[model samples]
Target chain A: FRKRQPSVASLIQGIRDGDKTALSRAITLVESKNKTHLVQANQIIEACIADKKNTLRIGITGVPGVGKSTFIEVLGKYLTNQGKKVAVLAVDPTSSLSKGSILGDKTRMEVLVRDENAFIRPSPSEDSLGGVARKTRESIILCEAAHFDVILIETVGVGQSETAVHGMVDFFLLLKLAGAGDELQGIKRGIMEMTDTIVINKADGKNKQAANLAKIEFTRALHFYPPKENGWVPKVLQCSALENEGISEVWQTILNFKDATADAIYDKRKYQNKFWLLQTIEDNLKMQFYEDTAIQQQLEQLTTLVMNAKVSPFVAAEQLLALHQKKLK
Target chain B: FRKRQPSVASLIQGIRDGDKTALSRAITLVESKNKTHLVQANQIIEACIADKKNTLRIGITGVPGVGKSTFIEVLGKYLTNQGKKVAVLAVDPTSSLSKGSILGDKTRMEVLVRDENAFIRPSPSEDSLGGVARKTRESIILCEAAHFDVILIETVGVGQSETAVHGMVDFFLLLKLAGAGDELQGIKRGIMEMTDTIVINKADGKNKQAANLAKIEFTRALHFYPPKENGWVPKVLQCSALENEGISEVWQTILNFKDATADAIYDKRKYQNKFWLLQTIEDNLKMQFYEDTAIQQQLEQLTTLVMNAKVSPFVAAEQLLALHQKKLK
Candidate 1:
């Protein structure tokens, strides 16, 4: 038989005392699908709201083979060395299909996993991107309440995950690999606009010259973009995660960014909170509307008719909504 | 005394017989908020669904002062000269605020407006983008039923209207002017990814060299983007709308694109129909939920709390949702 779960009061007390086990359990509760667990999770979260600490949330993303794991591990170690308690989490929507391809193995971040001041959690391999993002967001609160001073959220550069992660973090860093002649081709549209900094990874050995060239190219390209709303010009830096060089400079850049945009950070977080509030409500509303059995049955037929141009989409949408409202009544 | 409105069947018959007056009246019905008018509009649209004709819907967007009006007028005249009936529509969401800044004055397209084979409609200066887009989409069906062979949808490049217009059209074109140093600066992110062709307008007199240079730069930039899923490579061309030069070449480029992406166009429209169906339903759901007085009142208070970090956004969202559901029940 499983041991009796701790009460909400004990969990809150443990989290305040910086108990890792309590933090992990709280995150599990947030990720749980069981209704009662969710209730308890909300209660703990409510209790921890007043415990907000001075925290910095950074989001890092790169395409596969960009050494995200090594970069994250090195960065986490650097933060911990500076007496900062660090928490590393991930938001990969495809993790369920890929069986947690990112951060799934503890061996990926061997040194950081063993660091006492570092807390690492793999991507939650369940639900949609909304669900995964919500869980990671709630876990940030739990981590901060447990006194983690820095949070690193990592995501793959593919798909819409970068947008989701960008919405939640204070600074967005993009990792890139130097290529022969198509360095900018791998960068997705709108991503350059979101990036606060671009770190060209694996810049050691024979790739050093190409990495330097990429840095100059990105810097010039960045000049064409208008300055960010916070008045911070994005920077491009070169790093070798495997060799653990240039890690300190990356941290220094983040520090300068924080100092430069202190007021903006406060306002940005507030705006992000409001965004998530509305986003969560909208996601829930859509989920409830789509999960209805009657609406689902009619939707399939209406979709086919719409595809065949036999019915206007607006009219079909009205019919589906009318059916849903009638059932609700 | 108000005149009696034509019946739906009579209106459909008139539209089928290529009566512009009937088409205009039908489009007015589609844009109306009156319950009865909407019912009649749906009936007319349903009756016209089987009337899908061989047509091409082209979306044209450019920044203000890019000579969009001149370009469209010349293009419309060209298509009409080729024995193709052309209908022009606008989808400016900001029209409500800017007093229909785009296509507001018919004098802008004076020449084409007088052509019997051409029809031009200013944007409906009311409602949100979704509402405006819905009206324009329904109007497309009405135009097709009237046997218009080519539909030109115009929008300004300032906002999300390009995306909304992109969803409804067969080919997307971006019109640009030769700028001093910031030619690419005016091009918004994600817009280039959607563009099937870019036309450098006003390529006459002293601007001819600059326009050609811009075309070459755009062509090189377009090559970096991976080929579209439809296997069509985007092209950049120069045009002088004032001189009416290269207008035929632009039309020929469109024809080539049409021949190359025939199968893709069929699948794309089907996909677009399904997307709009779900998008409309989702938009409607959010509208109904947000329009609640209780939700509005509570939302302001919850927003402050969430912004202050005194309450988690997820929890606050849940509270608001619970309240909304309770009222609905």
Candidate 2:
């Protein structure tokens, strides 16, 4: 008998039982833009929060062709072989712009895709910043509820998506190619600073020497950067997805990092949650003001006036705020 | 006749006539937090905007002991000797916090203070982000209206103020001391990218060789950074404010940069004005929302709840926003 409808409680129950189908449906709810789905998504997240399980959220980021998919596939298989359940999810906002998802293709990680212990989900198709952030974060909660101990969140290092992923994850890994012109070009400054571990991929064959040189260069470069709050120095490692080499070593480095910064990480997560709360409030407030019809009508004209320097920015802002206030009355 | 009343039109007229006293008064009005003074400030700014003159706005940043003041003094004197009026303004928010203003003190620049062609103003006492940015930017307009052909806006490279300074200036110069530990310590990443010219200060005497070495290192380091939209390569120069050597060369570099990126600089200012307009609106909206009494009252509890993971950040934000919306109704 096919069940046409299911209540939110039953969905939560199924997810708690580690049902992959329930996990997928739960993520769909969170990713949905519909108002009814959003409410249900919040309810599901609330229920999951009450029964939260521990998750090692690792964020992986690299430029395309940096072997990110291969590295993830190898790493995912390694963990699954160790008897840990793995879920690989993506937060690639650019995927929608490119007309297809980067990690959404099922063929890329064929082994991981078919592995019973491993689940792969692509990024939601939504493009709104707030919407995407909300969905990805909620999906993490659902994934954790489904007892996925190792959740790998993949994102392209090109844009603001790296920042979003960095905020949500416990560990942030930057995958880079060896001998790529100092291994720094095309990398954003903030993203480099946020990187917890720099992994040089495709280091198996003749590239081994270059990768080793890169490891030294990155080590020296990272030494110039101030140590993060956790006091664990960011490390550079060499890995070869083709040979399935250094996969466990990277995982061990992550474990050592977790051990070294347990207290700071715990406090950081709490602080981050509080930060997101305030940030959400700030964003919502701005959205409300900007969305007000009166403010919207005057925005273009005021912008032109400001561009022409006919009015000071502060005064222009006051005028718009006054318009919103007056209209509210 | 003792006249205490100066209408906005007369103030603008006096400013246009190069009356230093009138310029100072206009700047004071712009810096004022009083609601009444704000209206007059806008009028003065509006009138001054119409008569905007061609001025070279350079943003200079360095550490406290990086010879920033000495460099400014030498460079200011150099420009003034060439029959150019120079205005040096500090955006050192910390100076106010430290119980003394860096540029506010007249004794620091004994020669420049006494020079008829130079004007120096310290950071405003108000510490709010919007207040500081608004005051400094408006002061630039008043200084330009008062016939200051060269405006050197100084900010400590340690904070967000440098970014604000960079936004309003045509040229952003970073002053560094040679042999100062690679000369990159404590400087933020984004700051380096925004720099149009990196000047190695104190390059005279025994520091000359180290300064040259630092220049080379910086050039190589900067190569890794993406080029700005203006298509001008960021140059590194050696200067000694102590001996007044390289002052002319630095000025020449500025001239060359102006020649190379003239159109882009012009477009940048217009785009910056539009950006500031939108940014100011967003800030004001957030301030209004955050300043709501009921929302403030519940903020601490909500933050703790979010931190404890008892509630999702979005739900907490929704609750707070709903409360504010209900109160408005």
Candidate 3:
């Protein structure tokens, strides 16, 4: 299959016609780092987005030990059973740590793995975090083109990748353990404020009471937080993925959120779209400046001087920027 | 004074010789909007920073009615009595709002006003926040050149100006009222993380007990926050500027922070200096791009398309950037 490469036209057609193989191939093409493949990948992406379907994009995140896979499995199976096509994609930028930890154990997702309507893919490794994020964002278009009604993007909540995931998703769900004290330290400071919902997992046996206590604490804490721009108050609830309890309620909550903020969510997506454009321009401008040989040399010496307070950062930056502009002119 | 323009060499010499008039004039030059004065201002700044002294730069912020002026006046008089020369500068970008609210009332700071070793300047009116921040940061150098041992920058705690102040200051002190609920609403979130010390003011009269309770709550909350990069935990304390109480202890706490993180603080300043240089370059590049007439025309059209989702932001940005780059080449 690698030897007989399919054309971009056929690939787009297959994706529109709901060919799973074409969808997988398109994602692989986007994940490829080869120069030639990049050109073709962008072309395919452009075509896919032209006829893009509106899919529900949900981002799920939690620390390593917080039962993310178990929850995703239960949720994915539940959705598939309701005749909804689900695609599970991972955006683990720290690919080294979560290489085999997520989605590798097929038995963990036993019920969903056997279902024809479900698709699961591991995170793309061997790329920069930006690269991974860009690929994952592009892959969402391909997944939707293949008629996936629901797209769940899973990311490890320990690193900077959560911000990237948050930028691309419609609804952000933070999974937590019963004991919020120690585990909360692993999460970043502003993560809670960005969260749309907080789910306390492992609510069975002795942990049930602790989970209930956590729900109350989180609810009270969130009340003190400034309201999000969309006016959706973040909800906190407990679930035992192991017992498959409270699963439907979580789904209902999500539906309610969508209904309540239906008008505002479109505005949010438009904002995200425009934000990515500006972000790309900013990143590219910085890249261009740093790649210049003259600027890089001045930067090294200026960095030392600024560090020692021999010169102010503002003056040093002005000098460096002037040099770059002169070279450009 | 505005009619007689001083030579850059004379201003530099006067600042080095501890002349306050020269220092104030230098600050005015730096704040000038005239194109001709900009070149001279840069030259004067270059000279001032060449032999800049390490002054203790402290940033103070709080919402309206938090007794910011009273606290500063008490703190300023206390420092000057201990044989330290102090300079108080305001970084209020919204000068319109705080014109008569802060320091404008001479009776509020009667003691500090009569002190020979103190200097107080209002915020520069009719300038952008960036413009105000730049001028205030430059003014710090001028103050230090005149051998001021301590510099206190005042800013309202409501907007983006706090982050700018945080970028330029060595230690950040947040002034809060005893009423945590109403006062907290005025202060933005994520700000407490940036503070080095949280000072609860107006702790006299009926507010004393409430102040102590608020202190305990803040201390407990800080414990959950991530430790700062320099390993210094943010301290929360109650003070009664009205009664001139806890003034010495607050100074003692500041000295202790200086002693404990002496080496790390120097490194942090250097990092800040270098950070500003990069930031200046980034801002300038964006400004230049936006200023181009052709690109501005393209940007307006692309913005509407991106916002309406008629075109993807990535693609729209690519088109706009390509147009600018083509014109540049």
For this target, which candidate reaches the highest TM-score against the unseen true structure? 1
lDDT of 3 by residue, B1-329 (tens): 36487899999999888888888888888878887777788888877776756678899998888888989999999999989999888888777555653554667778887888998877766446777787888888888888899999999854688998998888999988877443345448778788899999888888888888888767766665557878788899888998999888788888889998997777777777777777778888887788878888888788777777566666677787887787776
- Please state the Cα-based DockQ of model 2 relative to the true two-chain complex: 0.59
Candidate 1 Cα errors over 4 Å, as ranges: A1-4, A98-101, A186-189, A220-227, B1-4, B98-101, B220-227
Summarize candidate 2's per-residue lDDT along B35-153 as a digit string, tens digits. 78888988898888756668899999987899888899999999999999999987766765676766877778889989999999988766664567678888998899899999999
**Winning model by DockQ:** 1
**How does residue B51 of candidate 3 score in lDDT?**
74
- For each candidate, the DockQ is 0.60, 0.59, 0.54
Reference-based TM-score, model 2: 0.94
Q: What's the best-to-worst order under DockQ?
A: 1, 2, 3
TM-score of 1: 0.95
Which has the better TM-score: candidate 1, or candidate 3?
1
Evaluation by lDDT, superior candidate among 1 and 2 = 1
What lDDT score goes with residue A177 in model 2? Answer: 90
Candidate topping lDDT? 1
In model 2, how large is the Cα lDDT of residue A100? 88
Please write out the lDDT profile of model 1 over residues B223-243, one tens digit for every residue: 655458798889899999999
